[model samples]
Target: MSHLSPRLMRAMDVAAHAHRDHRRKGNRVPYISHLFGVMYLASRVTDDEDVLIACLLHDTLEDVPQEYSEGRMREEFGDRVTGIVLGVTKDDSLRDWRTRNEAYLRHLAHEAGDESVLVSCADKLHNLKSILADHEVLGDGLWSRFNAGKEQQQWWYAAVHKVTSRRLPQIGLNGEFGELVRVLQRL
Candidate 1:
């Protein structure tokens, strides 16, 4: 088991503050919940302090760069944490939704290392659970909350699963992720 340190707590605080105004897409739930969910899921797999911290802050660089720049992350959390977060962040410069997502998928297949893959798997796993729950309530309406509709979303999740499976086959989380993907597809 990995012991939680002051830095881990600090990461939670920073992520909370940075995402304070943000909400889950098309919902009232605070965005920090997703960050915490990712961190909690990752914690079940490894005790690495940096990976946990990276999980907490993974979206900051992509979603709220103004609040938490790479420089700030490096200064506060150090290089490995910053690198893992960067590895998972989508290329917002692409503008087109499909283009950005494909870039991310390519990164996962080619460039992302174990730590990045671990954080991404946890993040996607949490999102899949939320999507499944929300789908029960909203049914087809839930697809409106996302940039891509059902088909594109399915493709993205499956692609992420493929990369994670190849990248971290030993990690049990990949199995859960794949199961969730299958569930989502059947919905």
Candidate 2:
């Protein structure tokens, strides 16, 4: 087994516990598996310890209400990891999801040199890869959840492409991710 620092191991354990009963859309696999997938991908792309930890904890603030506080994250994992997680979490109350997404992407672009960007890119890449895999199995429903609408979809597609092209050359286009980008553009 790969050895992780105590802090990182604790973050993974906390996220796993928080997401214990949850399952991914369509597949229904234990949601912690998704977190592990993201971290694994990040480890492949970058050796940054903070990025790996952030990937492990990425969904904790967004999906787990009880552990969503910034202060709690900071206290447990320190400011850097908490900031990265916070940077990626969406505000569901926003009336305009596209605008919120755009803002978040823009923030990621600005933070490109930070470990947060690596973590966020890994998270998005993992999600896009899963969608592509599900497309192979579930077909249109995968597109439906992601498609949203033409303008929103186009904006996200273009935005992610722009960011990936600019910031994530380390995670080069390959395998399912390349296909998913093509699928997004076709939508």
Candidate 3:
């Protein structure tokens, strides 16, 4: 935080406020904590300010209402950041879980680029980490938070790992995505 640039610092503020009332499913922790994990993991993959900012605000589009959509994100951040947030956001209109997950994967495969995948890579990593950690304690009860069950959740993670790993074969970082893939594959 003390080392972050002004642009990224502002993003942190926006994410904290936007998710002020949201809590994590696993332990009911503040949602901003998850965003922070994603931001930190994304930072490991790249120092690009846009990706880091997007990571912090990635859930904003998915969790916040239309009035607080990317338009506000654009005003607070910029088009680049707004676009990155939008890129990672799934269309909630698709009520069916599998359909929404599949469509999101397809969208990432076709439309999302390396930067988008970078944010996604960190996102998946942190999410998988939470799922595993909570599952260790809460066991199967943790799956209740997600629409997809254990098998389906595993499938999505594996699929996203394949696409994102192929898109970003070599991040030259500490292998966060690779570690995530390995960990998720073992599950």
Model 2 clashing residue pairs (backbone): none
Ranking by TM-score: 1, 3, 2
lDDT of 1 by residue, 57-160 (tens): 99999999999899999999999999999999999889999999899989988998889999999999999999999998999999999989999999989999
Off by over 4 Å in 3: 172-182
Q: Model 1: how far is 82 from its true place, Å?
A: 0.6
Off by over 4 Å in 1: none
RMSD of each: 0.9, 2.8, 2.1
Model 3 pairs whose backbones collide: none
Mark the 10 consecutive residues where model 3 has the least summed lDDT. 172-181
Best by lDDT: 1
Query: Per-residue CA lDDT of candidate 2, range 98-179, in tens?
Result: 7778777877777544566666666766777676677678766665664274456555756765676567555653333555
Q: What TM-score does each of the candidates earn?
A: 0.97, 0.83, 0.90
